[model samples]
Target: MAEALNAPTETANAHAESFLRDACATLDRLRAMRPAFQRPSAGKRIRTAFDLADECLGISVEKEALLLRQALADRQNLAAATSAALLRLAGLEMGYRRTRGYPAVAQSGDWLQNEQFVARNSDLKKWAESALYMSAAPANWTGRIAQALFGLAAGAAMAFAVAAAILANRWFPAESIPWAILIVISYILKDRIKEWLRGGFLRILPKMISDRMRDLIDPKTGRWVGRTREWVEFPAPSAVPAWASPLAAGEFNALRREIPPDDVARYQKDIRIQAARLRRAHSRMNSITEILRLSLDAWRERMDDPCERLRFVEEGRVCEEIANRVYPIGLALRFSEKRQGGRHLIRRGTLFVTRDRIARIVIEPTPEGGIAGGGAAR
Candidate 1:
């Protein structure tokens, strides 16, 4: 009877300890990325850190889900966290794409697959417009034009040679034999001239020049280009998808795996005030994500510059890649939501707040218009 009573206490202690460890790990991860948060304003700084967190979480959640989805019936907690974190976070942001706009919204997958994350992934349009490729253009086009001119120049020069041979009239019955032989020789000379001009002279010459000239160029990824900052507001919470709701357990747990052990350990010493801390963290996360939305949008704008040069003037392929990279990631971060799960699942994993994945935060305000989130409800 005593053992049974103690078992409950032991289990609670273990879970509590685990929770504390998890919290500490998350904070440490955030701190480790402190440089990512350094910006002009506190609000901007908050948003930058929050974006970093969101991206890291995106890797964790999808990878975890993929492993579990594949594992099917045989699933466990530690296995879930470890496997998911490895799969999602492993080389995740590194695989991120770049483009000009945010995706529609993605409820699943890592950062690379989403179309909206812009700078997170590399888009073909951006690549084509990049300064490196544009730098090669002037030389390439010049070589082609020279190659054509070579044909004309060789024809004219050879015609002169034929006339010289005809006038010399050195060979046979000065009538036509020498002229005919000269025709053969002149044709041969023309072939040699064509070969020399097309292969080694202007045609090949400009490639070297192009390589040198290519240095002073910047590639634009879109139809336009420039730099500026402005905030475009998101639709109110209702319009966003359920999966995007920050408080939904699935959405919450979605990034649980990325929360590290060291950060979790720090939280253990202060577990007593967990409720308050969680509230603060939640608000912090909300503020950060909001900033991320704007930042990503800003990044999208950066990619919109067009490459008017000969290299990337064809814009189709690059545009598609950008769309793929940015669209879904933006959607997942701002508006998508996940499905509901059982009670235990609620405590163990993240929940989406909306169908399209947007989360809602209820903000409380001081008389001064300052915001606080003291209440436990999200």
Candidate 2:
């Protein structure tokens, strides 16, 4: 009875230790390859990393188990070291996933184009409105009015001076002086003396507004809300500024053309495979952790009371089943058969190991139908 109780606890510990050793070795291998991985460009480095991850996924369970057994037989206490290495690798992979910026090829081209157009038009409208307002009327109406009034007062004062000059001297011609005064009065009321200054101020105002609007626009989508650009004078395509050539020019055209249909298909397939492998790894890690926890609990229970051997053995069997069960290649499977080309027969099904030592497949029912298991059948 004592041997029977101890057997399961010992087996669980050995298995956990073996798995951790193998994981640590894998992490070391990845670390060794880091320099070579970093040699590639950003995009290429991501592709290489995915390829390495795929290779890791392809490693057979039998080989990993054999390696772990050998390492354990050598009597190496590497559990803590292996666990630390595994955690480091996981952290690195997670950081890479977070920071890697792939081109938005999978996104809808029409949507992106629409957003770009909307943004461009919005900016154009704002510029047009600014230009029109600046050209049509002064922005500082009060200042303009004040200046006009000042000019009128000056003109009136000059007129009075000219009349006084005429009255005080016979040399000053009254007819010519009256004509010149009339011209000065007309110029002051029209505010034509300050026309050049207003024009300069208006140009600067539109530019400042344009700079602000450009800052607000999204760099990727170029979309902005409000206003229309029907009247805005957009620059000719050929006259694109050097600074804006990357954005305003057809820069994406070459990139788009470079990515053929076959490459796109291949990329999508690779992404799916990588995603599946990553999810599988994550699930396997969780299962391993649960197995260890269950094993430790059973061990502790056995230590507390010798009579609980049977219960501990039973719990150990459950942990062994969980550890030994092969996780499904794809975590989730969706039914392909559709009703009236609308709803699927089965919504989706996930593969999970039940506590009762059974691989239970739970499927969600489609709105149009009850529960079904046709995903694998299809």
**Residues 245-320, model 2: lDDT tens digits:** 3221376566744675211000000000122433343444222110101122432342322222222356447322
User: For candidate 2, which ten residues in a row score worst on lDDT?
Assistant: 263-272
- Native-vs-model 1 lDDT? 0.39
Clashing pairs in 2: none
Q: Write the per-residue lDDT of candidate 1 for residues 116-204, one digit (tens) a residue.
A: 54444234234323423312122245446665677677776677677656655755455576667776777677677666655665545
Candidate 2: stretches off by over 4 Å: 1-7, 40-378
Best by TM-score: 1
Number of clashing pairs, model 1?
79
How far in Å is the alpha carbon of 300 misplaced in model 2?
A: 44
For model 2, the local distance difference test gives 0.39
Point to the candidate with the largest lDDT.
Answer: 2
Q: Count of backbone clashes for each model? A: 79, 0
